[model samples]
Target: MSEWLSVCVAISLLLSLVTATAAYMLYSGLIAHINVLTGSPPIKKITFAYKFRQGLYRNCGQLFRESHNIGPKLPCIGVFYDDPNEVPGPQCRYVVGSILSEGEKDADKELQKRYEASGFQVFSFPEVTHVVTCWFPNRTFFSSLLGVRRVYPRLARYIKERRLCAHPFLEIYREGRIHFMGPLARQGDFYVPEVRRAERRLSEEDELHSDSDVSGVDSNSEYSSGSGVLLSDSRETSPADSWVHSPPQQDGGDRGSRRRSSGEVSFKELDWEQSGGQQQQQQQEGTEVEPRPEPSQKSPEAPTQEWWGVSGEE
Candidate 1:
C-alpha cells in the first residue's frame, strides 16, 4: 500500500511539471506576439528631437496647428535597437522618419553631417525617398525584427498613397557605419517630365496627320467636281450651236411652224413605239388585249311614231 501511494505521488508531480512548462512556453509566446504587434520601441538613449517629434505626432492636432506650415504631415516610423541601460550613451541608437522623396547625394551627406552634429546617427539613402530620425545601437536579431514590423507597414502605406513607382529600402553595417533596414514596396523607374512631354507631342502629331489626310480628301473631291470634263458629248453641245445649224427663217411664223412640225413628228414616233411595246408585252405574257365594250346607243324613232290622240273626255 505504501509503494502504491509513492508511485501515485510521483506521477502527479510529473504531470504538474509538464503543465507548468507548457504554461511558461505559452506565456512567453503571447508576450512575444504582443511585442511584435505593438512594435514597442527598444530601450535607447534618444535625443530631445526624437522625443519631441514623437510627442508632436501623438498630440498633433491639439499641440500643433496648420498655421505652422511645416509641410504636410507624413507617415513616420520609429527605429531603435539597443537597451540604453546596457549600452553607453554614445553607443545607443534611436531613429524615426516622416518625409520621403528623392535625395541628392551631396545634400544627403550634408544632412547626415548636420544630424550627427546634433548627436544623432542619420542614415541617408540617396536612392531611397525617406526622412528618418536615426541613432546608434547594439545590433540584435530581435531588434531587427521589431524594426521591420514597425517600419514596413508605414513604408508600404506611404508608397501606396504617394504612388511611388520605385524606391530602395535596405540597410548594411560595415566599418562601424550602421545602415538601417528599410523596405522597397514597388519596382519601376520614377516618373519624369520629359517622358510625359514626349508622349504628348507624339499624340499631337498623330492628330495633325489625321486632320491633314481628311482635309486632302475633301480638297480632292472639290477639285474633281470643279475641273472634271463632261463625259457625254451631248452634254457639251450648246443651245447656240443648234440655233446656228438650223435653216434660216424669214420670220417668227416660219420658226414656229418648223418647231410644230418637228414636235408633231416626235409625237407620231412616240405613239408608234408605245403601241409596238404594248403588243410585244401582250405576246410575251400569252394574253390578248380584250376590247372594251362600247356604250349602247338608242335607235332613232320613225317620224310617224309620235302620233298622239286627243282624249275623248276633253
Candidate 2:
C-alpha cells in the first residue's frame, strides 16, 4: 500500500509541472504577437493620447471611404496623433477598418473633450478633429430669386445663422474641381472649405426675400423699383438697340388692355416673362415669327382656355 501511494504522488506532481510550463509558453507567444503587430520599427511605448488620436483619424478615414462606397483602397489606417510628445509607434497599432454604418460619427466628441481636457501639445495647425464628410447636390430652380419663389429657405436661413462664407460641401467638390484626396492618411492633406459660394448666394437671396416680405412688396413690384432713369421714365422710347437687352413692348391694343391686371401676376412669373421677352425679341426682330407650326393637326381646344387666368389671348 505504501509503494502504491508513493507512485500516485509522483504522477500528480509531474502533471502539475507540465501544466505550468504550457501556460507560460502561451502567455509569452501572445505578448510577442502584439508587439510585432503594433511596435514601430524600433519597439517602444507610444503615448496613450497619441494612440487615441491615431485611432480617431483612422475611424474618420474609414468612414469617409465607406460613404463614397469605395473601400479596400487603403490598407493600414493612418491617424493624426494629437500628442506632439507621443512618437509614431507600431504601424499596425491602429485598425484600418469600419463597421457597416452601425456607429455615430459624433461618437468621438467625448474623445475630443478628453484630449482637450488633458491639455497636450498636439500639432502646429488647428486640429479639426471632428469627422464629417458633407455632400451638396446641384440646385435647379425655375425662379431662384430672393423672394417668395426661393426653395430651401430653411437651408438658406441656417447658412445665415452660421455666417459661413459658403457651404462646406461645395468647397470640397466645386463645379469642375477634381477629387484627389486619397492614399491612406495622405487624404488629410486636402483642406475642405468650411463654407461655399452657394451658401453665400443663399444668404444674400434670403436677406432680399425677407426685406421684400416684410414691406408687403414683391421684388418685381413697382414699389420695389430703384431710382433708375430707365425705370422711372414713362416717355415712350424707340426700340432698344441690338446690343441693349430690354423687355419687349406689348403690342398696342390688347397689351394696353392687360395692364389692369397688376394684382394677379406673381413676381416670379413676371420676371420670367420679362427676361424671356429679350430672347423672343432677338429672334423675331425684322422677321415675322411664322406662327408656331400649328401642332401637326388642329384639334378641339379646351372650351375654357385659361391663358394667364383669363378667358383667351385676344
Candidate 3:
C-alpha cells in the first residue's frame, strides 16, 4: 500500500512540472512574436500621474465634443505593473495610450498640442488588431507564466467589446515624432481656441463677400440685357426716321428719274416697316433675333448706277 501511494505522488508531481514548463515556453514564444511584429520593445512601466493626466484630457475631449459637436472622447488603455506595492509613489510607471481614428490622425497641430498638454500619450499601430496592457513584468519567467492567462482573456474581452479582429498590441515605451504621440506632445506658440474662432470668422466673411460678388454679376448682366434691347430698338427706328425727314430732290427735265426714286423709296419704307414689326414681336416674346447681314460695297454701287442710268434716260 505504501509503495502504490509513493508511485501515485511521483506521477502527479511529474504532470505538474510538465504543465508548468509548457506554460512557460508558450509565454516566451508569445512575447518573442509580439516583439518581432511591433518592431519595438514592450513598455513595462508607467506612472500613476500619467494616467491621471490622461483622465483629464479624456474629460476635456468630452467637453469639447459636447460644446462643438466635434468628436467623441478618445478611448484609452492603462498598463499596470504586477506589484504596485513594490514601486515608489511618484516613480511608479505605467503606460497610458489612446487609439486614434483615421480623421483624428491629421488633426491640427494646435489641437494636438492641447491634448498633449492635458497629459495624454498617443501611439499608432501599423496594423492595430488588439488592445495591449502589461499585467506582468516581461523579465520574470514566473510572472509571465501566470500573466498569460489573465492577459489573453483581457485582450480577448477588449477585442470583443470593440468588435475588432484578432490583433496584438505593439509595445511602445517613449514618445517619438514617428509615433502618433509625437505630434500631440509638440508645443505651439498661438492660442488654439482663439485661432480657431478667427479662422471661422474669416471663412464666414469670405462667404458673404462671394455672395455679394455673385449678386453684383447678376445685376450687371440684367442691366446689359436691358441696354441691348434699347439700343436695338433705336437702331431699327433710325433709318426710317432719316428717310421720312429728308425730302427727295427733283432735277429739271428728270421726271422718270424722280418717279423711279419715289418708287424705290416706297419699297424701302415697306421693307423697313415689316422688319420693325418683326423686331417688335421678337422683343415682346423675349426671343433673340438673328442679326441682318450688312450690304457689301458692290451692292450699294449697283443701286447708285441704276439711279444714274435713269437720270441719263430722262
Candidate 4:
C-alpha cells in the first residue's frame, strides 16, 4: 500500500510539472506574438504616408515651376464651350479671345506658334467637338494646365465672373487682346529683356530730367537779377526812365497786341474828321479876338517913359 501511494504521488507531481510547462510555453508564445504586433503598430502605415506626401509635394512643386514658366506666354488661351462629349465642327470652330491671335496679324500661324512653344502638339480629332490639345507628357501635362489656370488670379477671376469658359478667346478678342498675360518662358529673351531695359532707362531719364528742371529753377532764383527783393518791391522801385529800356514782363501775354503804330490804324476817315473840327474851332477863336487895340498904343507910350521907375523924366 505504501509503494502504491508513493507511485500515485509521483505521477501527480509529474503531471503538475508538465501542465505548468505547457502553460508557460503557451503564455510565452502569446506574449511574444502580441509584442511583435504592438511594438511598432504604425510603422508601415507611417512610411507609406510619408512617401505619398513626399510624392505629392514633389509633383506640386514641379507643377508650380512649370506654371510660372508658361503662364506669361500662354496668356489664358483656351477653347470655349461646355459639353464634354460634344465635338466641335469645323464650321463651329470660331476662334475665341486667345492671346495666340493677339498682336498676330496671321491667325493660323500665331495659333500654331503658341502650341509649338508649349511643347504640345496640335491634335484635331473629327470626333471631338474640340479636343483642346495641350502638350502634356503624361500627367504632368494636366498638372501644368491646372497650374496655368491658377497663375493669374485677377485674370482668372475676371474670366469666371463673365463665364469666359463658354468662349475661351472671344472676350480677349473683344477687349483688344492680352500680351504675355502671365509668366514667360525662356523665349522671352527675344523681346522682354530689351523692352524691360528700355523702360527702366526711360524711367531713370524722366527722373533725371525732373531733377534738373528743379535745380535750374533754384539756381535762377539764387543768382538771377532782382534776387533778395520782394516781387512787389522789384516792380515798384524800378526807375521811370528804366521803363523805356526794360523789357515788358513776360507774364503779361503778347505786348505787340496791346499797342499798334498809326500805320496799323484802320480809321483814317475818323482822324480827318477830328482835324476838320479842330480847324473850325481855330477859325471861330480868330473871329472872337478883338484888335490888340489902341490900348496897346496908349499903354506902350506909358511903358516907354517908365523904363526907369527913376523915371525917364528924371
Highest lDDT against the true fold, candidate: 3
Task: Estimate TM-scores for all models.
Answer: 0.18, 0.17, 0.21, 0.15
Better of 2 and 3 by lDDT: 3
Indicate the residue-level lDDT of 309 in model 2.
6
Provide backbone clash counts, one per model.
5, 5, 6, 14
Tens digits of per-residue lDDT, candidate 1, 58-135, equal 222221222112222322323222222222323322234322222331324444344345443333222423322122
Q: All candidates: CA RMSD in angstroms?
A: 45.3, 29.3, 37.5, 43.0
**Per-residue alpha-carbon lDDT of candidate 3 for residues 162-196, written as tens digits (9 for 90 to 100):** 43321112222122111111000011111122222
lDDT of 1 at 180: 33
Ten residues in a row with the worst lDDT in model 2? 303-312
Off by over 4 Å in 3: 28-50, 53-89, 92-314
Colliding pairs, model 3:
45-93, 46-93, 46-94, 47-93, 47-94, 129-167
Runs of candidate 4 exceeding 4 Å displacement: 1-68, 71-74, 84-98, 103-118, 121-314
Q: Which segments of model 1 are wrong by more than 4 Å?
A: 30-182, 185-314
| Model 2 clashing residue pairs (backbone) | 38-90, 39-90, 166-195, 166-196, 167-196
Give model 4 RMSD, 1 decimal: 43.0
Q: All candidates' lDDT scores?
A: 0.27, 0.23, 0.28, 0.24
What is candidate 3's local distance difference test score? 0.28
Q: Across residues 32-133, which tens digit of lDDT does each residue of candidate 2 receive?
A: 211101111110111112112222222333333432232222111112111111212221112112111112222234443454454421211122222212
Cα lDDT over the full model 4: 0.24
